[model samples]
Target: MNERLRFVDPTALMHLSRGLTFNPLRSAEVLDDVLAAFDEKNGYVSDVQAWVRGGGLQNGPCPTLPSGRIVADVTETMNAERKVLHAAAILKLEREAGIAPGVFLSMVSPTLDVGMRVELPMRALLKGNLPLEGTYTVYLHVLMTSDGRDLVYYGITKRGWSLRFQEHTRSAISRESHRLFARTLRDLTAARARELHGVLDERPKLRGLITTICATGLCHGEALDVEEAMVEKYSLASKHANGLNMIPGGAAGLRAAQRFKGTH
Candidate 1:
């Protein structure tokens, strides 16, 4: 007799009525049919679309139906109609070589000529290491062409120091530098940054600038893990005659609103 423990076997009649009589095969078939119906019914759409349709546009474009709504192709709203990231080649190499984290963060200065090219020389911070432990060092060189269309890439030291991974830079890159670059493009396109620049034209708010920067990066397919922390540290406050309250989700929401409007 252990305390806080009790067990009782059900009577045969009770077990028959409650648990033993059920047909698991039929029950599974019914569940499968329900899930299929749910998927087929287009249940993934949100209520926001319906709400927009219901609300009449007063100051901006006309809103009658799908035709009169202020709708446009979202792809057209992006800087280049699509944002692409190139991690495949680097990932492949890393996989083959069994590289880990915290390996290298070195610089490879480029040579600007008929085309931009760089020859990287990594000092190999760690050697004779296991793959599943820490970050591995991989030398990389990227060049943004003058035309802003082409990218020149070179991955050095895996083989020879000067062997180039031609056109490898065309792959979409996920890095802080790329994040900042995408932010600039979105700001120029959405006119959000320009608006802020015009309004606070004299002395700009530093935190506002930072939030905008982070938000723009998020919009252009980048994520900063500490975004919430950044907002908590930098957002503004409002006070009424009786009391003061912070706007819920302030800077982050503003950024999301801009994103929803295809501004980002």
Candidate 2:
């Protein structure tokens, strides 16, 4: 089994934008093992197996299947494209969770028409596994027009979309404050940013004018209106340039608005 494991070369640990690379035979073997476990222990359905059977090639286009359902018809060709589909699923779950909408979330102005279209499907493609942890990170690019409509490009991370914010647990505000009080607040804030983006995309009046602010170093101590959980998350983002900064402080409206305009 260990030999087979060695034969099952995992995907390379590298930045995603460079390109997609994989070991087909090894990947095939790993897929087989995963499918076997899903069936034997996870109680995954036959249809799900069918999706992974092809190594995910055949499963993605079937729009009829629900998002959370495991799939089997995995094809190397399909693996790359399925992120968007899965991301939409996670977005649906987020909406269902009924988390409070961030105060800063709002729509773009109708007269502006200044932004581009951000599709839900493409955003899903960015979802994949993370380097530090085996969790997923869903990446999304949102477009806000001056006219108060939004375009969002969303997807799972390249490694695996399941890697992000997987550890989030609901607790009393006091308890939540204590858990993240001393910890880095970047992840918590980024999660809030994503959540706000998800909601702003739907609300036409707000038009996708949502903003996220991330500050680190000396700035972390400064007071802000953002939730405590988000403060932690944003702090981390600033540290890595992986954080969100839509707030007026870190990056002013002219800069961020330009980025939205693609002029930056």
Q: Compare the candidates by TM-score and give the number of the best one.
A: 2
State TM-scores per candidate.
0.16, 0.21
Q: After superposition, how far is residue 23 of candidate 1 from its true place, in Å?
A: 59
lDDT (0 to 1) per candidate: 0.23, 0.29
lDDT of 1: 0.23
lDDT of each residue in 27-81, candidate 2, tens digit only: 3354445544544653433433243344342345422223342322322322454
RMSD of 2: 18.5
Worst 10 residues of 1 by lDDT: 208-217
Q: After superposition, how far is residue 63 of candidate 1 from its true place, in Å?
A: 60
Write down the RMSD of all candidates, one decimal each.
28.4, 18.5
What count of clashes does model 1 give? 10
Q: What is the lDDT, from 0 to 100, of the residue 107 in candidate 2?
A: 22
